[model samples]
Target: MLGIGIVGLGYWGPNLVRNFSAAAEAEVRCVADRDAARLQKIHSLYPAVDLLSEATEVFQRSDIDAVVLATPINTHFPLAKMALEAGKHVLVEKPLATSRAEVLELMEIADRKGLQLMVDHTFLYTGAVQKIKSLVDSGELGELQYFDSTRINLGLFNPNWSVIWDLAVHDLSIFDYISSGKKPVAVSATGISHTQMGIEDIAYISLFFNDSTIAHITSSWISPVKIRKTMIGGSKKMVIYDDVEPTEKIKIYDSGFSVSSPEDMHRWLVDYRFGDIAIPKIAQTEALLGVAQDFVSAIVRGTRPISDRESGLNVVTILEAAQQSVKQRGQTVSLV
Candidate 1:
């Protein structure tokens, strides 16, 4: 089994620990957190696992073949770099790093060390998203025309990053994955800070692709109601993904419009067609478990993971461009 060490026990750390512990090919051998209470709680639940107050101990231990980092956003690059330098595979939480340079540095280290460097983009492993990817890849959705996503909730303000970095990052990853090899050419964004913390609580981003495809994302931390929805429009069909729905999370619409030439030279006839909507049944496996399995498999098989360094780099590049656009007051920033 691949021995795994986890850093951080707050927020999303516990889920990682649970999934890694349950993975058949992997085991959570060590857990490190500065918070004494969190360590105590982990020890109480998992007495066989080693607990460390300092995360550096996790890197020093030779038994740990891999390390999963669920630490704060600012700590990801340093911790990942240290792990890769120590010859340990690394799985880090999303956005990879705040800047493209940091991500490239980590990627270079991982490549030199021949270690598996994966990013924990949990949403990509979700059943709904998996189904959506299948549909897109199978040409069932035809050529994608536009992608629009909205993810907003109240009172989960992050101190280190703005709403765009915190929330829009998810949609960016999703867009990157479903778009396959298509890359965004330009980005425009706008955001505002409402709290005394001086961090943005609401933001909007728009991405432009070379195929004339467009994507818009809206992220907010002060919405009255929670919403996690994405709309993908194509030439032949459309899709609506509502993450909050319990049973039916994905609905595919067989609807589109067509045009016909009229006798008049200046006027043409437009035809609209609305067909049946189909809801595909999705498996209900836990997404974190899938992520854990993929991480361990990548390490053992010496293969690139679904959420590898390149994917992380793409997401981070978009985020960097969006941040620039926001700073320039919604001026379109070129991603080229």
Candidate 2:
């Protein structure tokens, strides 16, 4: 059985503990948090698991085969590096690190240590996203034209990270995973710091790919209602994935219009196609559960996780570029 230690019993840590506890081949042996109150809560709720206020306790434990880090974005690199160096497989929460350099360092360290390094990109593990990836890979979506996503919420903002890193990273990771390794060439972004915090609360980012694929991510913590929606339009079909939906989270629209201008030799004609919108019946499963299962499976079998360190690095690079662009007041930042 895989004994896992979870760090940071903050917002996402409890979910990780719950999921890891539920994994068949894994056990949440230990959980660490700096907050004494949080540690007491965990101890009270999870009586079977050992709880500690110091993260070092879990890290130093010999029984912990793997460590799940749900700490802040800035601390991710250090904690993950320590875990990896301590001969423990690591599962870090999104963005991997604050910058690309740290990401490369962690990847290199994990490679040298020959330990499993997985990023917790929970959205990519969802059934809706997996089904959409199937459509894209099967050529059913045709050549991808544009991917637009909006992830916004009210009042759950983190002072440590910007809106782009806090919310936009979700769409960015989703875009990266669904694109099947297509790298964005450049990015332009704009953001506003509303709360006098150094971090941004609202932001819009545009990612340009070599192919005609362009992805736009808009995130805000000032919105009245939470919006988690993504639309992917292609030459053949269009798709909509709504995380807020309770029943059908993904809907594929077989509707597209084509236009040919006089400049083109094809002649000046407009083609319109309309078809039924099919909501693919996707199985209901918690994303965190799937992520936990994958993380443990990777540790036990020495298999690469879907959201490995490289994938995490890719998402972080885009975020870093986007932030750079934002700092320059929407100047286009080249990824190359």
Candidate 3:
């Protein structure tokens, strides 16, 4: 059995513990958090697992083959580096690190130590995303032209990271996984800081690809109603993925448009096509469980998981560009 150690029992940490415990081929050996209250709470729920306030103690353990870091985005690099140097496989939460340089350093250490390094982009493991990938890969949604998403909630504004870093990463990661065409070459963004913290609480980001494909993401912490919706339009069919829906999360529409210019005149003719909507069945399994299983499997089998370090870097690359663009008041920033 693979021994797993988890650090940080904050928002998503407990869910990581629960999923890792439930995953096959893995044992939740230990969990660490600085807060005494969080430790006591976890102990009350999972009495069999050991607890520690110091993260290094968990890394020093003999049984822990891998360490999962659910700490703040800023602390990801140092914790992961320590775990890697300690000869432990590391699973880090989204964005990997604050910058591309940090991610590169972690990737280098993991490679040198022959350890499995993965980012916990949990949505990639979801049934909805997997199905969307299949549809795009199979040409069910032929020649994807645009991808648009909106992820917003009323509260939980991050103190350290911007709204783009906290929320836009999800849509970016999802787009990175599902799209097989030319990667994004530039980004343009505009954001607002609502508080004195100077951290962006709301943002609108747009990505330009080498191909005709384009993507737009709107992330905010000030919306009155929570929404998680993505739209992917293609030449043949379009997809609407509403993560808020308990069931029927994916809806495929056989809809598209066409335009052509006459030989003699300069005006163009436009036509639109509308067809039936299909809602394919999606697996109801917990996405976090899949993330746990894949992380463990990658370590044991020496394979690449869906959300590998490279994928994380790709998403971060876009984010880095978006950050620069936002600083320039939505000026387009070239990726290359």
Task: Tell me the tens digit of each residue's lDDT in model 3 across 222-276.
Answer: 9999999999998899999999999999999999988886776777787999999
Taking all chains together, each candidate's TM-score versus the true structure is 0.98, 0.97, 0.98
Q: Residues 223-329, candidate 1: write the lDDT tens digits.
A: 99999999999888999999999989999999998778678877887889899999999989999999899999898887667777788999999999998999899
Q: Which window of ten consecutive residues has the lowest lDDT sum in model 1?
A: 301-310
User: Which parts of model 2 are misplaced by more than 4 Å?
Assistant: 261-267
* Worst 10-residue lDDT window, candidate 2: 260-269
What is the lDDT, from 0 to 100, of the residue 22 in candidate 1?
Answer: 90
Q: Lowest summed-lDDT stretch of 10 residues in model 3?
A: 178-187
TM-score of 1: 0.98
Better of 2 and 3 by TM-score: 3
Q: Write down the lDDT of every candidate, Cα atoms only.
A: 0.92, 0.90, 0.92
Model 3: lDDT equals 0.92
Residue 98, model 1: Cα distance from true site in angstroms: 0.8
Model 2 lDDT per residue over 117-228, tens place? 8899999889999999999999999888999999988978788889899888889888888888789999999998987777889999999877778999999999999999
